[model samples]
Target chain A: MDIKAYIILSLALFTIGIVGVLVRRNAIIIFMCVELMLNAVNLLLVAFSKMHAMSGVAKASPYFASDAQVFVFFIMVVAAAEVSVGLAIIVMMYRNVHTVDVNFLNRLKN
Target chain B: MNLTTLVFILLSVMAIGSAIMMISSKSPVHSVLWLIVVFFAISGHYILLNAQFLAIVNIIVYAGAIMVLFLFVVMLMNLNAETEPVKNYRLQLVGVITGGALLLVLVSAVMKIDVEQLVEMKVGDQGLIKVLGMNLFKNYVLPFEISSVLFLSAMIGAVVIGKKDETANQ
Candidate 1:
């Protein structure tokens, strides 16, 4: 497949994620939108890795294309850890405020 | 035209559709469920790109674990559609317009870049577990160990934050 097609698809998905983050007021939905953006980036990275693998330089190194996939792996790891901590914070916030609306989280302004 | 392109189009539609549904849904639980559908569609894309390791990991980690955590939290909070907070329609309109503007700028910039490359579809072994494992343990061993420490810290942080604050309660 043409790399441009993948790029466009990934860009569209990322745009949808950006829209989700901006339009939603729920903190959890916002977090999910962030995850969607991360996945879009991951998909593009893998596509680019394949593009690099098809290049002549990759003939010299068998592992040339593996770097991007490894980066995606670590991204997943960090995202998992981040979700744990973030959800914990969200839960604590709900306990205190009883709502997940981002608008109500303005205590810092005072 | 071919099967690969056809599958790619299908998966892209699935992902984008579910993501929109996730944001538009009123209930947090529904949003979480829709997000899982998006993850599965992305996993399908990973598989189409021949990144089998990432395909499996994305399903297991994102769809299975993290989404379940989100669902659990939503249920624990007893958040339903009726309890959902409403925002002014003008603010939502502004947000949608802003997001659309950002997309237009990014898409235009990306179109200007010269990309004559082809993505290797189901034809590469670089995405296999063996290659990834060798690279991870050989060249990237330090980052692997550091990631474990990061996980530990995150675990501790979650526990510390989630624990009932007796002092604050008193």
Candidate 2:
């Protein structure tokens, strides 16, 4: 397993997600971009979990090797929750303003 | 060089390409579809890494549930046509520039890391559901239950926010 390659791939995906969040104005798309970022992190963590499992020091105990995988599960749970709340917020925004664009959400400004 | 490496490269290309298209696509629905492609590619990677459990969950949670949620919201908004508002070039340029800089910095840092004592992969069944379930239920039970609470709160919050107020209707 070329760990470097996995890391690079994960990083590239993360970068694409960053660009998506930065460039998009649509609230739903922006939320999707955040999900993309979360998936990227999940991929990297899985790769690291595999790497740790392969290392010699951790050969005896397999539990330490798979800890990151469990962490990824929690991340997925949090992401699911976030999606529900975020979509609801976007829905509420649409109901009040009649659009899902984030540009009109500058009411926090002075 | 080997088959696994080749497969990894192929999946990586698919993932990155779909991701780029997801952001650049003119329609939000298309973006969601592209994002699904990316998720599938990532799931393929998980399979390649021998993590079948995660790969399945990725498909079920992300592509099945979350993406359908996105599509439903888009459909509800009546944004079938290309209706996104146009923004100035400066904001986009700034976004692109920042993203590019972040990529460059992270990639360079990644390349500099030297792994002198890396071990060969054992191909153990660590990614299996049985092992992960035991670990999750035994050691990580608290976090798991707390996450359920988080989900409950999120469900309530979504319902509260999405429900139409009767006072505003009249």
Candidate 3:
């Protein structure tokens, strides 16, 4: 696989995700965008791992060898946990406010 | 025009298109469905990278479990397109500009990297299951052990937060 192409596509996805989170008023859409961003980063990390693996230095450097995949694994775990907690919070917010609009979440404002 | 490049092109297009659709769709349920498609496309990319285990886990966890939870939440909330609030035009413009700027910067930086040097690296043949299993069990065992604790905490947290408050007047 062309690592650069993967990197570029992932970057594009990440950018779109950022925009989605920023522009969208719906909380569910924002959560989806956050997932998109996380997936994008995971894509880049895997590409880097493959690139490093191809370089043969992965075996020499203990950190580079298996750590990349391990790191991705940890990231996946964290992302999963985050979604559970985050969606719960969103559900709570919606139940209380009856709206998922981000702009109306200004009840904390003085 | 090689197999890798061809696969990359196909998966990238599918992933990006579904991602865009996930965000842009007016219906929340439609967005969740599109997100599932995006997750599958990403798993395809993982497979192309030769991480078969990761790809399978990716599908099972993200596409199957996580997205199903999202769909349930949307349905339980009774969300519909008409109820969704519309964002102001100025914020929309700013978002598009910001996203475009970030994409330009990232692409330019990536373009500056030396691809030939990266390609010179020798690829390993240890498939996903073998290499990751050995490494996770061997050198990075501590993190592997800690992850269980993390998962336990997350489960508890989810239960606590998701529990309904019956005493509080609705």
Candidate 4:
């Protein structure tokens, strides 16, 4: 595998997430974009994990080969938890504002 | 290109395309569904990388659970195009410009990277469930437990924050 391809793919996904976050008005859409960014990072980490396992230093211990993969697991865990909280917050916001438009929630601005 | 590269290209296009559609789609429900397609494409990438455990987990956590939560919230909100306020086009133009600039900066930075070093990289069987499980339980057990605590707190916080107190409102 040319690891560069994975890097390019991840960068594309991250850019998409960044664009979504910047362009979208809906709270749920922005939240999904954040999840997209998280997934991009997860993909990069897994690719690096495999790359490192193939390299020299990880020769002594196989455990080190999966280190980055484990980080991906934690990321997925945090994402799951964050999705629950974030969606709940979005739902609550919709209840209060009657719309999921993010621009409407500037009441907290200084 | 070999089959792996071909598969990689297909997954990449699907993922990036769906991600774009997810943001542009007017309906939040359709956006959520598009995001699910992105998740599945990412899972396919995981499988191609030989990270089967992560592939399955990606499907379960992302495609299964998180997307369902998003769908539920969207439906509960009863949001449609008319109900969904449209943002000013000027703001959208700026968003696109900024996003495009950032993408250029990042892609340029990545272009300078020395991928030749990684070409010699060899993958072990560590990505398999058995190896990953040993690593999780033995070396990373503390973080594993810590994540559970994080999940518990998130659950409590979501419930507390989302609860509608009718008496207080009345």
Please give, for every candidate in the order listed, the TM-score of chain B alone compared with the true chain B.
Answer: 0.97, 0.92, 0.89, 0.92
Please tell me which predicted candidate would have the highest TM-score against the true structure.
Answer: 1
What would the per-residue lDDT of candidate 2 be over residues B1-170, giving only the tens digit for each residue? 88877887899999999999998998888888999999999999889888889999999999999999999999888785468865678998999999999999999998888974331343767788988999999999999999989989999998998898989769
Candidate ranking (lDDT, best to worst): 1, 2, 4, 3
Candidate 3 lDDT tens digits, A23-89 = 8899989998999999899877877777777777637544454566677788889988888888888
Q: Which pairs of residues collide in model 4?
A: A54-B122, A54-B123
Report the C-alpha lDDT of model 4 over B46-145, residue by residue, as the tens digit.
8887788999999998899889988888888887766766678998889989988988888888888876535222235767899899999999999999
Provide the TM-score of chain A alone for each candidate, in the order shown: 0.95, 0.95, 0.89, 0.94
With a 3 Å backbone cut-off (N, CA, C), the pairs that clash in candidate 2 are none
Ranking by TM-score: 1, 2, 4, 3
Predicted structure with the largest DockQ when compared to the true one: 1
lDDT of 1 by residue, B56-95 (tens): 9999999999999999998999989998886788888998
Query: Where is model 3 more than 4 Å wrong at Cα?
Result: A58-64, B118-123, B166-170
Write down the worst ten-residue block by lDDT for model 1 chain B. B83-92
Residue-by-residue lDDT tens digits, candidate 4, A1-110: 77777888898899889988888888888888899999999999988877776676747775777888889999989888998888888888877778888888898897
For model 1, report the TM-score of its A chain.
Answer: 0.95
The runs of at least 3 residues in candidate 4 whose Cα sits more than 4 Å from the true structure, single-residue gaps closed, are: B119-123
Report lDDT (CA) for all predictions.
0.89, 0.87, 0.82, 0.85
Which residue runs of candidate 1 sit more than 4 Å off their true CA positions?
Answer: none
* Tens digit of per-residue lDDT, candidate 2, span A7-102: 888888988888988888888988998999999999989888887777745666646677888999999999999999999999899889888879
DockQ of each: 0.83, 0.71, 0.59, 0.72
